[model samples]
Target: MLDWSKATKYSGILQLYRNLIELRRNKQKNTRGLMGQNIRVFHTNDQTKVIAYHRWMEGGPGDDVIVVANFSTQSFDSYTIGFPNSGTWELRFNSDWKGYCEDFTNKGYSTTAHEGECDGLPCQGNVGLGPYSLIILSQ
Candidate 1:
């Protein structure tokens, strides 16, 4: 059998767990979705090994959340992604943050969204994506 107490002392898993719990608790807007709202896989780029999607209650703005993920080993400095609206979107969580794990490359991530169009959406933004990482952005 594994010694659970000894394992917790050596791992930062608890911190990550706490962060996730806090996020879940604070994101009231996402509650609708959490309670069987909706999920849409908005974009996918096989060449870049990237995928993006939105989760929301009625699929408008405020409650809307976007999630981007990179599956490739290569990082993208300014990878473009579609936005549901033309407005500011804040980076809520980044899986590559060094706080989660020391070996991760703490890439300078962008916290603001830019206006444009991609993937059939009215707005777009560029983001610094770390290899094999996931990021959540919200208004």
Candidate 2:
């Protein structure tokens, strides 16, 4: 049986995922990040061959932003990401949908994704990701 701690962790992750979804719906995002001119997109079409997926070029100003998608119908069992430490982080965009929450001045949540600055991490909190969902972050 799964450990009780893991179950709590999963629940916490789900909550964060939900917050991301809600935040995405309520904010606007920055386009292209620091490397919009040379943006790289990551996605998949085949689930079975994901183990041998093609690798793409990676190198940027460290302030550059990244976007990722699952592409497959099945959800990811687990995944990892690496980023340079700078400050608090927030998910501002997703591949599945457009974001507009940052434009709080408008008739929206009155919050901006690109304007957020956490403590170099996602609140050191749980994270959940849904199928075909995209994840965007800011420094």
In candidate 1, the residue pairs with backbone N, CA or C atoms under 3 Å apart (3 or more residues apart, or in different chains) clash, namely none
Per residue, candidate 2 scores C-alpha lDDT tens digits across 1-139 of 6466665545644454675655434334332343334543332335422211111124322234544454444444334333333334455544333232221111111112232233342222212243545555544
Write model 1 residue lDDT over 1-139, tens digit each, in one string: 7577866674665666665565555454532332335778879999989999877766555567787899999887788888877667767677777887887775536455556678877788887788898877777
* Model 2 ranges off by over 4 Å: 1-35, 40-63, 95-127
- Clash totals for all candidate models: 0, 15
**TM-score, per-candidate, Cα-based:** 0.80, 0.36
lDDT of each: 0.72, 0.37
Q: What's the true lDDT of residue 36 in model 1?
A: 35
Candidate 1 lDDT (Cα, whole model)? 0.72
Alpha-carbon RMSD of each model:
2.8, 15.4
